[model samples]
Target: MNTVEAPIDIATEEQSIEVKTDNSAENESTNDTSNLDKTEPVPIDVPENPEKIEIARLSSIITNQTNEISDLNARLAACQQHYETLLNRQKEENSREKQSTVMRYAQAEKAKLDSDKRCEALATKNNDLLKEKDNLQVKLSEFKLMNTKLQNAYEHKLSELVALKKELEKTKEINQSIDASLKSTLNHLKGESSHLKEQRESNERLKRDLNEQHELNEQLKLQYKQLTEAARAIPTDDEQAQALDTLRNEHNALKGKLTNIQDENKLLREKLKSSDEDRLALENVIENFRQTTMREKETTKKLYDDLLAAREQDSVEISRLKQIESLSNQTLADNADLRQLLEKEHQLLELTQKLTEKNSILQSDYEQLQLLHKGTSTDFECIQKINEEQKSQIAKLENIEKSLRDQLKELDEKYQTVNKLYEQSAKQYDDSLSEIQTLKKKHQANTKDLIKQLQQLQKPKFTNNSNEHGPMLLTSPTKPIANKENSNDNSSSHGSPTGSFSSLNEITSLAVPGSDHIPRHTPAHQQQQQQQQQQQLLLDEEQEVIVNIVDIDRQKLIDKLLKQQKLLVRRNEKIEFLNDHIQLLTQDLQNKRKIIQTYAMNEDSFMYTSTESDSIKQQLANKNRNNSSSLMATLYNRATTTVNHTTNKLFEQSSPMTLETALDVMGKLQSVLEDTLLKNITLKENVDTLNKKMPIVKSASTMSESTTNEAREALDCLHELSQLLNTGLDKKTLTACVRLLEAGVHPDALAQIVQVLRSETRTTKL
Candidate 1:
């Protein structure tokens, strides 16, 4: 009954251990199931509730297996402990019995040796005694000496025995101490064995638990693999199928979005192309407009220039009319002075006639007195005839004197008229001299102003020097020679003095002779008349010379005025044309500016859209990366669990009793664990590398998108600017106006227009 009860107690203990192991394994299985729940994909074929049932069933089985394994491990540990304790006790008993038998045999052998030594000594001693008695009897006389020798030897032998006995006692005590130490050692060994048995039991429990956990993991892994395979092989449930369909639909939708994006890109490209074309057209139009504006400006300038020229011409004509009126007044005054002188000459002629009549009456009275004296005297007839002839002669002489006096008076009047004409001519010459002086002052001021302008322009001094010298060379030498020749001719004409008027004596002599031979009237009168006519002819010639000089001066003034007026007109026209052209250009510039602003706004909008698209793409990529990482983590966990399960199965398949095989398997497992750790480290390093690079990739992507947008905006702006330029060009054409001005129509205005055209052409080229 006690034996049965003991077996029952052992069984009960085992069951309790199993129960505990079952609880621990159940907890572990629950943990693994929870992890699986977190990682596992939704079952494709099974219903949601069915998956829960299957998980519960797997947990229950795992718990049962763990309990059985724990019980077996507990039993194995208890049996090994009992066997080791029995072996230790048997070894201790056998050693004690062997030690006792060896000790008894050694004692018996020592006793036997001692007995043999004593018998040998007694036999030798008996022989020696008998020999000694005989020797004593023989040598009764040396008996005392021999007795002393025997006594000394006996004493030495006794001392030797005492020492040997002490040695034996010490050896016996040492052997007893050795037996006590052996007993103590045996007790310690027994205690150690018991401790080892307890430790082995604990290790067995741990191993059993580990085995159970491994088994449970294997079952779970197998179930999961099976489920996964089934999910993959079998058709999914309606809901799962619907989810897959939705995913497919999403993929198709994404593709459609991509296609739409491509289409938008194509549209953008087309828009860009159209914008470029529009830019080109606008540029052409702008060029034309600019040209036309220039032409209109040139035409307006020409008209203005012509008007100014006409006005200047009118002004010049007015000035000429004023000069002519002044000259005519001066001539009329000179003619009046001449007419007064002629009237005085007429009065002198009448006075001379009255004087001639008185002189004739006196001559007749004298002749009559002479004739009466002649008639009374002897030769009265001859005296009377002589007195009559004397009277007749006297009368003729008075008539001649009267005629001479009249001729002299006419000559004096003619000289007076000539002198008056000369005075008038001198006054006119003085006026001309003053006018020339004024002209000279004006010319000097103009020359100085020209020189200042030339200096401002930095004109070469060589050209100015050449111009001054060229005119000097052309006029100076010839003018000096001509002046000297004229002076020489004047001196020669004066030296002759034949036509020169002498003092009043020559005048009297010439007048007296003419008066005396007056022929009493007719011949002297006719000769005086011819002289007066000659003086009048000379006066008329002088007046004609003055008229010719005045005409020449007037013509020159007219020409100069016409030229100046024309120049002023052209300059004014050019200024007006330039103003109009500038106004047109300003309008064109304003239009171009507005177009550029619109283009800039559009470019900004495009940039915003591009930025948004880039952001969306970045978000999508990040989402895809996160999903991939989660999937990899799930797969890695499943693989690790499966590997652990596989190792447990391999251990179970091997024989536990074969220590060498177990050791080999343990070494392999150690190597495999090391390899797994290395792989884990490598994977962790890879993940760290990816994590470190993520910011850089994001920054690069953002930069690329920004650059692309900036480039597109720049291109658009350039296109718009080109379009504006083309539009401006299309609005005007200036070439025809330029050509018209090129002709001599408005030369000064034309020159200005040419300059403007050149500048515009350069700008367009640029």
Candidate 2:
């Protein structure tokens, strides 16, 4: 009975240990654990009996097995500690990995942001370059226009110069004719001067004869006095009386002769006064001629200097034009360089995109590795638990076999749970990688197509000016979208098969106010699940930045197109303006020509009226003579052509035409002007309608250019006509000049034709 009790006690203690193990998992208090440790060395009962050797053998076997169990338990405890340490280390490693991943993600985000900034800057630069190119194109067009205008102007000037040379030659001929006429007039005046001088000499001789006659008259008077005295002294006799009477008669006769001499002298004095006046008039005429010659010399010198200066200015302008051409060539080279640089930047952008994709892939792989490590560790822990349960069951096979089986099932379930988690993580990672690769491929294709499209769409611009402002750019209006669509558009904008719509939709679908991905009412378990799911779907900061960048780029495309449309509209407006200007100029020319014709038709009556008005003008001129230059005034005073002034005044009058006729002409002219203006308005309306219906931008631009050239030509012809009018033209030249308006010729063209005719005239005359 004692031996049986000893075995029973040992069996009881072993059962306690198993019970403690079962309870230890639920109640892992230190007090409970210490109590379990204290129970490790329990006393066993021993009794000496006849089967002592069997008892000893049983005791030894039990002791050895106990030692073996303790050793195994110690090994198991060490293993459990080692596994716990491994778990702790793995947890720490996973946390470090997460931190590192987050850090890497932050760094990538920063890099992406920096790259985006660079891309934005590059895009701005590209836009600026495009604007510069447009401005350059505009400037080049302007320069070409200026060059054409200058060429036209130069041609006009050359024609005018030729015409002026002809006019100058004609003027010289007229001057020579005037000089010949003046010489003849001077000769006539000289003959009159000589005749006046002869008259003066005759008057002086008559005066000298008159003085001698006066002396004779005085001498006769003295002789008469002496005879009277002798008569008075010896006069009483008839002979003396007769002698006195004879002397008195002789004195009376001498006095009569003296009176006749005095009358002749008085006549001579009046004649001499007239001769002196004639001589003074001739002297004044000679003085005026000298002053006129001097003024003509100064005018000739000034003209020569102006011609030389104009030649110098032309040469300078030509040089300046050559320099401008060189600058344009340089601008072309700069534009080519800019294009190459843009291509390089585009390549860089592509490479950066690829790098970002690779980084994201690397991050996904690291995450997969963490999941694999956790799954393997969980499986290892489950296998160790199964071995521990097996060892415990072997030690208490009779008591705990069923419990161990239950534990094995639990262990298997945990292993399956860990395995499923790993599979899910791996599957998710693979899906994400596949999506990334597909996106990259799509984006690459889209980029290639976009590049090709851009190359095809690129056009030459006009001006070289970099500072020019382009047409305004307007963005499309924004709209909301579903959360799912927002995500889809984001991905599609960067990586869709149909990139155009995707890109366009990205702007409209930028923000989703409410999303399913956001967690709602959550239990602890559900909250945990939601957290895990959120972690899975959450994008890194870098990816968010990339999406924003793509959206911005899409918007830029829309803006660029809007700018182009605005430019087209502006070009049409310019064309219309040029056409309107041309119409106004043509109408003006017509009105001026009509006025010239009207003036010509009434020239005779105008001249007669002008002559009638001259007397008043002469009085006014005399009043203002002090204000006028004495040089010309004195010359006019000494002029020998008194018949010209008396016959007809050369000065024009205020009423050069009759009031009624003028009013009628003016009213008709006004009506014609109104009609022309109406026609211009109708033409402008037609042009506006055509432009609105189908504005041919290039053709409109060309038409404007041509119209501008025509207007410049017209202006040149008008200028030449005005210059010719200023010069006192003969009737034939005036007729020819006025005939320029007969045909609807451009001013420059008319100038050319007139120049040719004048050349012929000069050649024939030569």
Candidate 2, residue 507: Cα displacement in angstroms equals 99
- Which residue segments of model 1 deviate by more than 4 Å? 1-238, 326-766
lDDT value for candidate 2? 0.53
Question: Candidate 1 local accuracy as lDDT?
Answer: 0.50
TM-score for all models, in order of appearance: 0.14, 0.21
User: Highest lDDT among the candidates is held by which one?
Assistant: 2
**What is candidate 1's CA lDDT for residue 197?**
50
Instruction: Tell me the tens digit of each residue's lDDT in model 1 across 97-135.
Output: 334433433333333334455546555655665575566
In the range 492-588, model 2's lDDT, one tens digit per residue, is: 6455343444444443334222223444344443334333322222222223334543443557557756875686578668757975896799689
